[model samples]
Target: MNQSRKLCQLCGLPLTEDQSFLSLLGIMSTDSNNLCEDCCNQLVLINDIFCPNCGRLQATPEMCFDCIRWQNKGYPLLEHRAIYQYNDVMKTYMQQYKFNGDFLLKDLFNHDLIRLIDSIDKDIVVPIPVSHYTMQTRGFNQVSGMLNGQTLSDILSVTASKKDHQSQFGRRERMNRQQPFALSVSSQLVVGQRILLVDDVYTTGNTMYHAANLLYQAGAKTVKSISLAR
Candidate 1:
């Protein structure tokens, strides 16, 4: 679609056109039109000064306290990157997309996610799986939809549970979550392969670590991660 005619994915404002000659080359892509100027400015992108391990926005490029603690507690540390800081704008977008089940909102970061996934050099990308209950209620796995056609290995599934949302739990409770994820019985495909885990958000890092632990035990050679927000 043409830029001026396209509605912003987040705010629904009409976008301005890119009059550059690249438009004629079919290279002036959706990135330039999906987010209007105002909504774009609201996004706080992660800078070089963020945590190297978890991508948490911080003053220095050191591993965040949580990641350090994870290693101390005998969990394998995941090298991570995030596209945006978890600010108020991201919180609102997450609520609208994940909680409210607005599946279309997944495109809000489509272009960026494609770029991020393209840069990652891994044998396979595995999106963190949601529980069956979440799939039935929310109608989709939020992380799975944001994966823009990368190499996917569906190696994990959430075990049946009666648990509440992760966001509703305290930090200690979140960290203490039981093994809610399990490898598919046929998931021997990741053996000795580099794996990259993708998820929508990194709150306490519990969920990703849980999946990574399972992947590592299942014989994955290495495990890294990327999330849309941190």
Candidate 2:
């Protein structure tokens, strides 16, 4: 499709004429499924000072209170990175892409995600898996959808069929929920490898920590995580 006819993936609006012109003439590069300038501007990238542990945006680069709490509980600090802030626009995008099952919306951030993953150093990239019930109903894992066909190690699986969605629980409930992940591969396979865990969002750091704990127990040398949003 021509640039002039291309529609913004998020808002479903046609690219502005000037944008098309610049893109067509090679003055500015653009993705095939681009977000219009307005919609793109609405996304708040976490480029400024942020919590080093959790990737949460903040005034300083120190660890946030949530990470401190996790440390106080004896959990090792996690080094995480996120692309965007979980703002109102991101919430809307996630609602449509995940809850509403708009599969094509995965392409909206495909290039960005691929770039982020490439920049991270790890021996294995393991996307956090959804419960079997979620896979049956949702037809896809949202984290895997955003990977854009990159290589991944399917080393983890859900521990059980969760009767309730994580979003349904409050902060305390989520933090207190039982571990939801188990390693699918042998401990020997994980030993001495640096594992990178990918997820759609990092809410309370509960899910990431749970997955990381299993990798560490199985003898992973290090565990790092990345998410599309914080």
Clashes of each: 0, 0
The local distance difference test score of each candidate is 0.81, 0.85
Per-residue lDDT tens digits for candidate 2, residues 1-230, read: 46578787777888877766554675432243366766666788887999999999999999999999999998877789998899987898898898899998987777777888899889999999988988988999998998877998989999755665686789899899888888887899999999999998888999999999889988999999999899
Q: Lowest lDDT 10-mer window, candidate 1?
A: 19-28
List clashing residue pairs in candidate 2: none
Error of 2 at 24 (Å): 7.4
User: TM-score for each prediction?
Assistant: 0.88, 0.92
lDDT of 2: 0.85
TM-score of 2: 0.92
Question: lDDT winner among the candidates?
Answer: 2
Error of 2 at 52 (Å): 0.7
Against the true structure, whose TM-score is highest?
2
Off by over 4 Å in 2: 21-33
> Which segments of candidate 1 are over 4 A away from where they belong?
1-5, 16-30
